[model samples]
Target: MQNMWKCMEDLDQYLTYVGGPAGALALTGVAAASAFYLASRPSPEAPLVPLDGQSILQNKDTPSGPEMIRVSKFYKEAKNGKFLSYFHEDTKTLYEGFRRGAKESNNGPCIGWREGPGKPYIWANYNETLLRAKNFGSGLVAHGLSPGTQTFVGIYAQNCPEWVITEQAVYCHSMVLVPLYDTLGPDSCSFIINQADISIVVCEDDKKANLLLDKSPKSLRKLVVVKEVRPATYQRAKNRGVDIVKFTDVELLGAQKDYPQTPPKAQDLCTVCYTSGTTGNPKGVMLTHENVMAALCSVMAQLGPHKPNKTDVLLSFLPLAHMLERCCENAVYMVGGAVGFFGGDIKNLADDMRALRPTVFPAVPRLLNRLFDRAQQEISGSCLKRTLFNMAMSAKESELKRGIVRKNSLWDKLVFRKIQEGMGGRLRLMVVGSAPLAGNVLTFARCALGCLIVEGYGQTECTAPVTLTVQGDHVPEHVGPPVPCNHIKLVDVPEMEYYATQGQGEICVKGSNVFKGYYKDPEKTRETIDSEGWHHTGDVGQWLPNGTLKIIDRRKHIFKLSQGEYIVPEKIENIYIRSQYVEQVFVYGESLKSCIVAIVVPDVDVVKCWALENKIPGTLSVLCNNPEVKQLILQDMVAWGKEAGLSSFEQIKDIYLHPDPFSVQNGLLTPTFKSKRPQIKSYFKPQLEDMYKILM
Candidate 1:
């Protein structure tokens, strides 16, 4: 503290001493303010954003840890459901129906290869799945192979039993399962495999097999293919010295059932999920059984116990390749919960939701954002639609505001129940995570969907599940308390400077769920995990009085403007992308800017609709920059910006509505769907330069 004061004294020239002692006090205040400015600090109450930071602060702005813990105890006691528990002797015992039914998994809904939508009565607990995974794993180990001490096996398929089969088999046999994006190309797909020294790879279908087979890296030895992969595909692959084996061939060597082999220890490594690679090169995030167990415990501790007897059905949509889906997969297994796979491609989520409709669901903010955007667009483009929608929305919003948040509502019955029914009418808990969600989303999902909605904060490094908002803590943007036994701390982080002067700081976490370290990178591991065992999470966060953790943005993401104020682009982009016309947005203006700027990928349908209304020529995308088109988009941007109460400095000064969506094919985005800001800015410099030309 003395050192801080001495440093302040060195900047005495800027001090104003206008009224003697009062003046000196003012000067002290000025010094403190300067310190805050130098670090781009926001006080505890005012986070950089309202919904995210404000909601969190409401839950945690209490005096001390004990006080917050006390509040947590009260909430837990008040919660309607049972608390989640780790699998004990009692939980491990199989129910009579489940034990008998699991053995005939092949006859029930085949969740594996050649599967259709889902006959989920078979679920994740299918006896066939357990046998297949165990046989494949044990056989591989017995083949005189170490199986794997720390190798990466990338799973590049959609939601199928093969995905989990390969994962469970490998992990139970002491290998790390690396889930890859099904969209990655040969070069990028092989880059990480080579970098991580992966030798044996298990993938669904021959397409992925060919990727590994084509310009194959030398480090990889055996290529294991599942489902659609054929023996013929290996001919080209074998020329390159890669031993291509079938999943069936690999499974031929193990004990069937009734004679279960050794189980995986808690500390053995389990999975590795690649980082989004938005900022730089992709990294392989290695997780162990301990990490997976920790995340489950953390999540379960907070959500309370799952009532398997209640017959909960969880819909799996968001790519199973993601850590979020993987975590849910593992958790459901502990409770013997049924898992329903979403039908159709990613584009048909809404359509499929109406088809398979599970009891519980998990989604990213982008998915939830699309839902709201679609709802608004439905209401906007029509007159009668707008009137009815607005009436229902207003009533629903009012009930939410009045704390009457539950399943019984006339507005929901009339206007929103259809959406719920489309999702199979069994949604008990709708979980959202992986990004910051708007409070409005939480409120609407609760009121309209007639289910408990949850939001959480986590990273790939932590094996995904961390602090999650409990069911009853339905407040917007508030990520609920730390999972059962985990510890979350708000340290004075250097990353806090990027956010506006709302309360912000770096969030450090340590708990049963935190990772051991990065795979094969000790120096990097040491840098992230401090001596006291706390992981230095790069995120800046605020805590609400109720102990919900609200993440602002990454500490390293803070970029300065020419006017000297900081701008957190992530927060700004979330606001801009709320428009129905917008499909993707990338906000920039880090260094030389009086304010912020953005580039956008507008939806073709929305643009076409606008183009027709305005009688613009040359098609929607080509007409996007037409004087008429630009004017129309600009009006929406301006109106939306104002509605969010944003200052001009943070408003979008220019937009290039690219018709092209960022894809791995174009190298514009990471496989995880996060925009590569630097690449986008560097690629579109001309338009960016031209954008400021007229605005100034």
Candidate 2:
């Protein structure tokens, strides 16, 4: 006690020597703050809590001789000889689901859109939207579109009210909906039209209608223009014996007569979605009504408490032609949530978000990465701001570790409020899919946006999502357990040395959600789906200890170096693209070579900024030819590869900086934003050879 008093006396003397009572009080406050910060920080030794249920191994025999893995609910149900096919008992078809949603929400907003830039969204209530859908269906009947599963209705447009109306109309008439996008090009569009035997197509505008007429599909007999029909387009269509009519006129014609609704059976075909193939012709994935409903139910079941409600709003920007966007929109519609589409321009997405204030946001990794890069650039200008932002992120990350998400916390209010507001302040949930998001970007999005961000894994054949990250689970890399509708198992790829017993191999899925077959391609369908009904996804995945799935490599994209080491170019490209200097990258390797090389599309703004800082002068095209600029990007990519723990063979040995990006228009990238490997290699054959020669 006497010694403690002596220490206190010494402290008081030190405080007095430093300043006075004010200094003492300031030091005390600092000590308290430090203690609080330490307390709130996540413990280094704390165990990570598992976010998903345990995977139950099915004892049933499989073709590959490995036990299938399934979630407990599904395993139990299968064991009991029962399976879930729908979320709601009465919701058999998409049309029935929409009707149920309409009845539930009543006068609530169903779909909304903006008239022009900087304008508030105009909403159409559930009943009104349903009525319009009916009118449109009747109009189709008036135009000689027969109501049956055999009838195919093509919709070539971006996401708009008209697209949804057309889709619902097809559902109401028991017709198959075939979606087409401009990115697919005229040849592919014409092929789809002829393949589906489509007589009439709903075009977004005159350009699409004219493109269709120019292609002159053999089956096309009429053009239904959502926007005004141009005189030239009308004349061209008239010359081809194809009738051109406005969308409103079709609705008016339908309203004149009461067309009986012909809802499709559960097993009836719903859509023939064509994939954005990397090579050759695009394959049409035929999904039945049961297939789509099962996927929708599984997604909703996985969402659990975070499922969309009547009050929720989703911003529709991703192409409606893609199954991911289609499934997400259908999920929203199934629950009576409002969907507001973008203003047809990706540049204006932020403005649209601000106007819509969507509660639920579905995004792709490309956009999230851009947002992350923008935030980093903003903070790079000020060291003090950067330091505070880092501290705030650290605190939020600690809270996330404890499974807590807060939007009104002190750090959120001060540091992340602007980020939240930028994405529409009401955002409570975000679903990211279509590609694997960088772990750091995923973490930053969750922390900065202060919302439940989940990543899903799937493809067009599965009708959208197969697995989704669990809500309130902030772990980054792994896509969570399989949804209830499907059972997941890994098949050994002996050539790649990936073994199912070791929990690493090609992923295979079997469930109600699997598509019926590839449209008109029985051989391709048979190749994709094995005799046991398992769809062999070409993706290689590792089953994490927590029963989650981490995508490791793609079997189809895997190649080997001369040294006998296998390399996955997509994985390497994903790593290199993390470098701020890179915008898009195509990593190429020859089996005879010892190392890989890359064709990098440099980020123009970042490169210019770096050039200006270094006192270099050149336009982007000129800079692409500069040796120093190439070295700069190569060094940065190498650094990123090293940081990512990539092997020596995986590290890009050399790089060619290209000013022009690989895009759909250039035919070097697919419509889905995947690099068309053969085309890309052909396009840059000389550059690629030159880089290897320099390395030699």
Q: Of the candidates shown, which would achieve the greatest TM-score relative to the real structure? A: 2
RMSD of each predicted structure: 18.3, 14.6
The sequence of per-residue lDDT tens digits that candidate 1 reaches over residues 371-482 is 5545665566566555555555665555444334444444444466556665566677777776566677566666667666777777777777667765434457667665
Error of 1 at 207 (Å): 1.8
lDDT of candidate 1 vs native? 0.58
Candidate 1 residue spans exceeding 4 A from truth: 1-125, 142-144, 147-152, 183-188, 229-232, 255-260, 278-280, 305-310, 347-352, 381-384, 398-408, 494-503, 558-696
